[model samples]
Target chain A: MRKAIAASAAVIMLSIGAIAGAAEVKMVGTVQKIEMQGGAATVTLKDTKSGNEVKVTVKDDLTLDKFKDKRIVDGDEVRVKYDDGDGVVTIFRKTAGC
Target chain B: MTKILFTGLVAGAVMASAAFAKDHPGREYMEKNGYKGPETCEVCHPGKAKEFLSTVHWTHASKVDNVENTDPAREYGMKNRIYTMCNGNDIVNNLKEIPKTPDAKGTKFSGCNTCHPGNHLSDVGSAGPEAEAAIDCLVCHSREYDHSKRKPFKDDQGRVVLGQDRSVKAALAIAKPTVKNCMTCHEAAGGGVLVKRGFAFTKENDVHAAKGMVCVDCHKAKNHKIPTGFDPNNWAHDGVRVACADCHTETPHKDAEYNRHTARIACQTCHVTRTGGSFAKDFTTWEKLSNGYYEPTTLRKDANETVPVYAWYDKTVANRPDFIGPKGSRSDKASRIYPFKVFQGKGFFDRKTGELLAMDFAPPMSNGDTLAGVASAAKILGIKQYDPVPGWQTVLFGSNHLVTKKNALTCNNCHAPNGVLRFKDLGYSDDEVKRLTSPELYLQKMAEKQREEW
Candidate 1:
C-alpha cells in the first residue's frame, strides 16, 4: 500500500512538470541587440552553447524596464524562459555570479 | 468546471505579480496614475531628491552658481582642471546658451550632454523645484532605462533642456545603482567601451565586478555625495575617497616577505597591468580628418597586456584638488609605487597670458570646419589669436582596473635584470640599482637570513 502511494505521488509530480516544460522553451545566451517598438521589444541573443542567434520578443513591463534602462545590453549574458508557441519570454534574467 | 478552474489559475498568477511590487516609500496614487513628470519623483521622496540635487552628478562642480560659472568664457563644468583630451575641452563643453553669432549658427548641441540626467546641453533637469520636471531619475536608478530615447526640448523659460521617458512603470523599476547603471554614461565616454577610464569589470579580470559588485560598492555615496579621487587632468573630489585598504587588510598576503611590501606598494601596481586592449587610444589630437569633420587623431594604443608607466605616489595624491598626481620620492614615508597609463596629445595655449585653452564646441566644428571653431573660441574668450603650442606631454591617469591574479608579477619582475621597473629612473643609486637587480645576490641574502633563523 505504501509503495502504491509513493508511485502515485511520483506520477502526479511528473505530470505537472511535463505540463510546465511543454509550455516553456528555456535558453541561456549573451545579448546581441535589443529593438523596441511601441510597447513591444525584440531581443536578439547569441546562444552560449549552439552559437546560433535567436530572436525573442518581450512584452512584460518588468522585462521591458531592463531593456529600456540598459540593464540588459549587448554582450551581457542572460537566462531566458519563453513560451514555446509564440516565443515571448516569460522569465528573463542576467547570468551573473551574484 | 475545468474552464472555470483555468480562469481562476490565471487570475491567481496576476494577483501574485501585483503583490510583488516593491513595498517602499513611493506614493501609492502615482503607481495607479501615470508618472506626471520628473518633479513627481521629488514629491514622493523629497529628502532623497534634495540630497541628490547637491551631487556632482547633478551640479557638475562641487561649488558654483548653477546658472553661470566663475568664468563665463569657459563652459559650466570646465572648472579649474587642465583640458587634456585632444588639447581642448570643446569636445565635451555643454554650454548653457548657444552663441548668437554666425560662427555658432550650425551648432545644435551645446556639447556632449548625452550622459547627464538633465539631458539639456545645460540646466540639468532641475536646479531647484523649478527645474524638477527636467530630472531623469531612471538614468541612474533603473537598469532598464533607455537614455538614447531621451530628447532635448525648450522649457517654460525658453531654455533648452533634456527630457526623459517618465512612465510610471519605469519609475517603479528603480533600485540601487548597478555597474550597468553607471555604464549607460561612463562606458560611452571617449566614444567607446573602456576608452576613457580604461577600467571595465569582467569575470576574467575583475573579481569585484564579476562577483556582482556595482560601482557604488567602492564609490560609496554618503548623503548622495560619491567620493571620486581627484585627477589633475579631470575634476575634484567631494570629501571621502575610494581605497583598497578600506576593505583589504594591512597585511593581506600570507607570506611575510610579500606582506612587508604593502607599506610601499599600492594594490593596483601588481594587479592592473594592462587595460583598453590594443585598440585603446593613447594619443588623441583635434586634428581634422580628410572628411573635414573635427575628430581626434589617435596615436599610441594599448591592449590587455600593455605595460603601464610607474611612479611614486603620495597616499593623499588622489585627494589633492590641484594636482591629479602627487609628487613623491623614495624617501617619502607616505608614498607608494603606483602605475599610470601615460596619455600624450597636443593642443593650443595662450602665449600672452599663458592660460590653458578651453572653449565651446563652436558652430564651425559642428559644420565640419576646425579652424573656424578655434577662431570663434578666441573671439569668445576676448583674446588675441593663438597658435598650437606643442601640447605633447605625458598626461597620466591612474591605472586602477582590469585586475587579474593570473598576470600578477613574480619577484623577478622588479629584482631581475630587464624587469618591468627601471631602478635608476626611480631615484635608486647605482649600487642600489645593482643590488635590486641582481637575483644571485638577493638569493644569497635570503639564504644567509634563512640560515640565521634556523
Candidate 2:
C-alpha cells in the first residue's frame, strides 16, 4: 500500500512537470491572412526570420488589445504567442508599430 | 583596506573618463586617425563655416515675410510649411527655446545634421556648442565618407534613445558630398524615393547626370546659398540666378515654332516624359511601435511609368495660392504652361471643420502618442469629429528632373483634338480649341503655302 501511494505521488509530479513544460511559444512574423469565424480567429503568419509559414488559431479568450489604436491587418509585422500543445494564439501583438 | 581604496579610486576615475569620453567620440577618433575635425577646418575655413551657417541648410527653415506683414513671427515663417517636420528648434535661432529632452516619440526633424556630416539627430543631446564643434568637415570636402553603418539609436523600450551610445567609428568615415550624398536625404524626403518631387532621379535617368555633370554644375552656390528659382518670395534675391536659359540657349530647338513656344512653355514640358520604376514607389504605412517610434508596415509598391501632368505655373512657385487655367490653357500673364507630377493619395481629415488632419503618417506624431486608428489620429490632431477622406486631394509636385531628350513630345501630341493636353480643361474657349485642332485650319495654311509657291 505504501509503495503504491509513493508511485501515485510520483506520477502526479511528473504530470505537473509536463503541463508546465507545455508553455506558449512566441514568434515574429508577417501576417499573411486573418480569418474570423464567430468567436474564434485563425491567423496565418509568414515567419520573417525562417521564411516558414505558421498557422495559429485564436479562441474567444485570446487577448489582442495590445495593438492600441491599430487593427490587425494583413501584411502587418506581428509578434504572436501561442500554445505549443494546440497551436492556438493567446496573444497577437503588432510589432511594426514599435 | 589600502588595496580596496586604491581600486575604488581607480574605478571611479575610469567611470568619469568614460562619461567624458562619450561626449565627443568623433573628435577623439579624428585625433587618433590623424584626420582633423571641424575645428581644424574652422581654423582655415572660418569664412566658409560662417557662410554655411547662414544658409538654409543650416538654418533648416527659411525666413519669409507673411502675405500680411502684421506678425513678428511671420519674419521667420517657413517657405514650405508642409515640409516643416522639424520644429523651429533646428533653426539657428537665439530666441527659440530648445527642448530639455528629445521628443518622446522619437520624432526626427530635418535639421543641420541632415545634410551636414558628423552632425546627427540621435546625438542631439549635444545640441548647442558641442554639436556645432562636431560638424564633420569632410562630409562635403573629402571623398571617402561612408555612412552605411549608421542606424537610429533606440532604447530597450524601442523609444529613440536620447543621448545614447553611438558608433564613433561609423561617424568618422569622411567623404565629399556627391550626388549620391545629396540624394541620401532628398530621395528619402516626403517618405522615400520617387515620392516627393516625382523625379525618378537615377544615374541613368538624369540627362545631366548621364552627361557627368554634377548637381553643383547648374545649382551653383556661393557662401553656401544654393539658387532655387522656384520660390516667388525669394525669386528677387541675388542668390537666385540659375535658370534653364542660363544653360540652354533661347533657341534650343532647330524648329522656329518650338523656339517661339519657349516663352509660354516650361523646358520640362518637353524634356520630362515619364518617371517611376519597380523599386520607385513606397506605399508603406508607418505604425507606432510600443516604444513610441513608428515603423513601416503593409509595404506595397507599384512600378509604372506615369505621364507628367501639365499645368500653368507662373515660374514664381511650383504651387501657387490661386487656381490656374485648365491643363493646356495659358491665359494669365503670371502663368505659363509647365509640367508637374500629380501625386494622388487618401488621407484623413475633419469632416466638420473641413481641415486636413495631419495624422502621424510620418513617425513621431507631434505628441508622443500612438496613432492606431481614426480615434487615435483625431485625438492627436485635437479634432472632435474626423473621418477618413479617401482619395481626397491630388498634390502637385514640380517635375524638373529625369529629362529624356529623345522622348520629347511632338506637335500632334498636343495639337490633336483628343491629345494628352486637355485644352478645354485649361479654361480655353471652345473657339480656341477648334482653331488649334481644326483640320480645315491646317488645309488653309497649306493652300496659302501653295499660292506662295505659284
Q: Mind giving the per-residue lDDT tens digits that candidate 1 earns over B223-316?
A: 8788765343344345566776655556666557777888988877887777552122222234332223344444323235457878887743
Q: Pick the candidate with the highest DockQ.
A: 1
DockQ of every candidate: 0.07, 0.03
lDDT of each: 0.59, 0.49
Global Cα RMSD, each model: 13.9, 19.9
Candidate 2, residues B1-454, lDDT tens digits: the string is 5436544544554454344334333456455654545455555357565455545555444443322222335333222232112111222211111122243323333222333333443232234555556554544543333433222344565443222112334334333244544654454344433344435344456766565455555666677677765523232232355766665656677567788888877787787766442112212244443333443332222212577667776654422222111222366765667766555434444455544444433323323332333454355446565654422434455566787766777666677787677778777889999877766544555576579989
Model 2 spans > 4 angstroms off: A1-98, B1-33, B65-80, B83-131, B140-142, B154-176, B229-241, B277-304, B316-329, B351-353, B360-391, B438-454
lDDT leader: 1
**TM-scores for every predicted model:** 0.67, 0.57
lDDT of 2 at B257: 72
lDDT of 1 by residue, A1-94 (tens): 9999999999999988866676777887878899998898989987767889999989976467667656566766676888866678966765
Predicted complex 2: DockQ: 0.03
Model 2 C-alpha lDDT per residue in residues A1-98, reported as the tens digit of each score: 99999999999999888888787887878778877766666778887668799998877331221121123556666667888777887556544311
